[model samples]
Target: MTTADLHTLTGAYALHALPEDERREFERHLGDCEACTQEVRELSATAARLGLAVAETPPRELRERVLREITTVRQEPPAHGRRGRTVTTGRTGRWSGYALAACIAAAAAFGGVAVWQNQVAQDARQEANQATRQNEQLAQVLSAPDAKTTSGELTGGARGTVVVSQDRNQAVFLASGMERPPSGKVYQLWFNDEGTMRSAGLMNPAASDDAVLLDGPVDRATGMGITVEPAGGSAEPTSDPVALMDFPTA
Candidate 1:
């Protein structure tokens, strides 16, 4: 096969998915080819790095597992000829068993790192959520009606002004600017009726004036919110919401 074909086969070889004939051909070519060997080595190292990205705890008995596998791998005996006598004169080493142990140790170290990163990420997410809810509370306070219209903004024109009726049973989310979601998803408006958030309707996430207009004689609505949901609005939100406006009521 050409050099280009060999390069393309590197990934598949690391995954052990190459066909038997192709595998044999590549092995034959590799026996005398330095470039192919380098390519395969680089790809194997890259695969090893990716494997490190997923943190997993190795079994406590991993050494035993390695030993078992090594035992099962049959070594080819040297043919009884002049070459057999020469083989006995060659270097005798048992480092291969030790090399397998090193590979397992490397895998375990990577698994540990991945798990640590995941934990750090999860904590950061929780902190962000707490900050968001606090900001929502502040917005609710700032938007409360007092026989006069009130307004506020999030940084970078990212926040929208909220207007609530004096009686507070009805409101409208007049959003001037917002990011658009991809196809097969929509921004759904909702009302927190007596602590239960209820769907009002979905809006055009891309339109300049396609407001997430909400009108409800909705009972005990303490929270007004908007969520980017699936193509069809969900019965309940499963993802983090985009906008959650809090309204003041008597």
Candidate 2:
């Protein structure tokens, strides 16, 4: 093969689409060509990224169609040059129709990777923004002039404190020394207003230094309590509370 033909086979080499003999010849050429080596490395990394991006299984029909095309596709005879050796015309001719199909597939795969990367970045940004807003709201409630702070102990050697802001209708609960809940179970928070009890939020029992900023109707709450419940939490306290702290009223 000519130097130009070997250079053109870089993509095929990267994709493992080159014929055995041509692949060996290309490897020899790659040793002396820094540009081809770099190109092959870049193409390989792109292929890896594309593979990671494609998480879903391809449709059954796609495999069936490709197999059908392989059976029907015809191969033309290779052209002879002055030295009686075969000379491929272009990228399409250098490899078979399957190689052209692969090129198209690679283009589509890269496009998918771009879209997947954008979606991941967008999700991360949204999560960061949400965390920022939550922190700000928590800070506002904790720093409020009318906020009330109280502390107490629980049943399982756990200790908890709550700071409530009647002005902002929010509260912050901090707890420690709670053991991790059993599998399929979770700790759930509750707000009791007069005799009515309502779910405040779920808790992570594994947290040694847990801090949760509770929202919704905090101004009317008479007390806060936590209980063990199912994994997703429950509408009401399923069991006796591990901890309970009454809000001071004057």
If scored against the real structure, what TM-score would every candidate get? 0.36, 0.55
Give candidate 1's error at residue 71 in angstroms: 86
By TM-score, who's the top model here?
2
RMSD of each: 23.4, 23.0
Pairs of colliding residues, candidate 1: none
Q: Tell me how far the alpha carbon of residue 106 in candidate 1 is from the true structure, in angstroms, after superposition.
A: 78
lDDT string, candidate 1, 41-138, tens digits: 55544533432233344585983475334323322222222231321110111223455466457868777656644664554344334433433332
lDDT of 2 by residue, 1-250 (tens): 7765566555444444444466556666655665665565555445333322324446989845754444233223222221444433343334445655665588687777566446645543443344445545666766777978888887678778787888778887766566656655667888887767788876543334455666467857899888888755677788987777897553
User: lDDT of all predictions, in order shown?
Assistant: 0.48, 0.61
Model 2 per-residue lDDT at 223: 92
lDDT of 2: 0.61
